[model samples]
Target: MTIPGHDQSSYRLRLEWGPTGADAVRADYAVVVDVLSFTTTLSVAVERGIEVFPFRWRDARAAEHAMRHAATLAVGRFEALSRGDARHVSLSPASLAEVEGVERLVLPSPNGSSIAFALADAGSSVVGACLRNAAAVARWLAPRVADGASVVVVPAGERWYDDTLRPAAEDLWGAGAVLDALLHGLGVDAAASPEARLAIAAWRAADLPGDLLDCAGGRELSGAGFVADVEIAGQHDVSEVVPVLVGESFRDAATLPPDGPRLRRVGA
Candidate 1:
């Protein structure tokens, strides 16, 4: 189950809207991307030692109830935070924390949690990925592939009215480029698409720290006062932690020892 692009025979692509589509996805390795910042923020929080709990769009109230009773902090979009009128934290990592004893973060985002729930159901193992955690995800995923395991990269896009747009196309382009590099050992195909080519050019031209500040998602976070988190998220391969959904809780994949004797987990 190596990364998809490395072996074309084990790769397949699928497009979906929100968490509801999780049932349709069937893969061993799942990569969920919400480039606008949901997945980005989640990765940052988890890497910082915060626990993330994803809730369905329809089950937000239940999530809030569980959060309150469990004394866990709730973090999610204001729109889908609750069913009746309950409030939940916004999707800003700055608003969250890097402290201990803050148990349970009930997260529901337009793109992030919805996609997360879906992937958790369909994927044998679901991992969160964003531009901020791109290199880390690639390094973590590269050698995790089993002999014939299937992998799916679900990019949580934004919604307009009732329709959703692919999480910034630039995110998908950038992530795809990284995956291509790690798994396939191939540089992004400049001929793939104009948008992809441009992203690759920008990625190669500028230093990572500088380029992250200028990317579309980076600018959005900067404008939202989360520029620092964006910077932290953009640091490549800084942490060896790969977040995985375990039941109702999320934990770092690095904590689990490798199952077989052959493949060893690489990063911390």
Candidate 2:
């Protein structure tokens, strides 16, 4: 199961970027990191008991999907404000924290949600990973790495204005945060790709929480007056909830009762 140019060994515990990366690696488990907002927001929502559905984009069907699930369709910050719907703001992590009584949410993002949908469609066990729950995700996944199984960590990087992939530092560090825990804490003898190694090194060299604030994604979001969101996204290892993708949405991994379709092993 080796991709032509990619080393098969690296598939064990690899780190890759964007949706293309998620498509390239076939793993038993996938941890998607989009720290700037999508995943960070998902982490917060799941922590507050909200089930989040990752939609590839914000389209007309978004409203319909929300209606089908009896969930709220989150709008962009400006859209929310313009519509006088301040209660359920866009992808801002802080805004999501303040939301209540919403059992489900349809969260659309070009980066994070696209990757999530791609991985889920591929039948991979997907989990939303962020700085807040990196270590916890690792701990939850440690024992699941049975022999011959691989885990792919996809950092859902931002899209440039022109729609090209922008390898974001926030996502790299976020993936690295989880990589550090998975590799060290699990003590698994897994092969890591060059990108994976670089991520781990970056995490080791960085003042994680502080560096996250200064990353390009952080600065951009903070400049837009979501400074609190940036700060909230940078909080390290504070959340114990592992947002696992089950059915069409993400719920806390701990709550995914073990009786059925339990985190299916890759290809099982």
Candidate 3:
């Protein structure tokens, strides 16, 4: 509920890319966008009625988290392909589509999961949004933000070799896609940063399917033999499921309260 030195006058619907940006915002809710393809994958799984629990790292802890919830562990793309089971899911959105008989899954990602975890750790409400369900997420959030209550749309960008952040075009577009629906479509009276306005402009100008396929994140997924995943991520405004994080698990936003309870900070 608080971020040190949070200037409420600056913006209501703020836009930020990367973990550091997320840390700078003081918001009632944090909507995370990671188009290549963590959030995209969540959108797909939520659509298919699978519960997703986000883990910050793909390690023993992640496996244990899944076990604790009686959920299956989603692996990395390379490992999933090596296993080659129809039920094997991973970071790839396409792979999740083929999985069956699993009601819940633990997905670990370097960017999206980490941001979601941080936001939850800070006791902020969290929602996962992407091109596929931007409009739905906007609709879900519009009525929930009370007057003067802030919301930050965070685009989880890729990490550079030196462990710094890289501004990803796909994430910008994804963040913008949600903002477009949230501000314009839903007609929320929210302020925006210059960077946010720029992102909104980019989203409006983008050809979506064509442009997303050419972006760095899209190309990387394609080159990794996950072309289908790229295509899945590019389908704009197609999904209705809004993945909301509640109690360490993501469920359909419709199943949650209109405005869910905020988390408490650790040891608070």
Candidate 3 lDDT by residue in tens digits, 207-267: 8798888888778878878899999999999999999899888899787775565643223
What's the best-to-worst order under lDDT?
3, 2, 1
Per-residue alpha-carbon lDDT of candidate 1 for residues 1-268, written as tens digits (9 for 90 to 100) = 2343332232332323244333444455666766556666677668767677776655648555564547454544334234333344556554554444555566666676777776554434677776656666666655554343445566565666657453465455445645554444532222232332344454455556666678776786688556766666565545556677776656677765664212221111
Question: Which ranges of candidate 3 are over 4 A from the true structure?
Answer: 1-9, 262-268
Which scores greater on TM-score, model 1 or model 2? Answer: 2
TM-score against native, each model: 0.68, 0.93, 0.92
Count the clashes in each prediction.
Answer: 7, 0, 0
Give residue 180's lDDT in candidate 1 (0 to 100): 54
Best by lDDT: 3
Per-residue lDDT of model 2, residues 1-268, tens digit only: 3477763344578877888778876678889999888999999999999999988785778898889999898887656656766685588888888887888899998788878987888788898999899999988777676456678889999888899999998888889888889888678667777778889887788786677778887787778677898899989999999999988999997887763245667556
Query: Per-candidate RMSD vs. true structure?
Result: 7.1, 2.1, 2.7
- State in Å the error of residue 159, model 3: 1.5
Report every candidate's CA lDDT.
0.56, 0.83, 0.83
Model 3, total clashes: 0
Provide the global lDDT of candidate 3 against the true structure: 0.83
Of the two candidates 1 and 3, the one with more favorable TM-score, higher being better, is 3
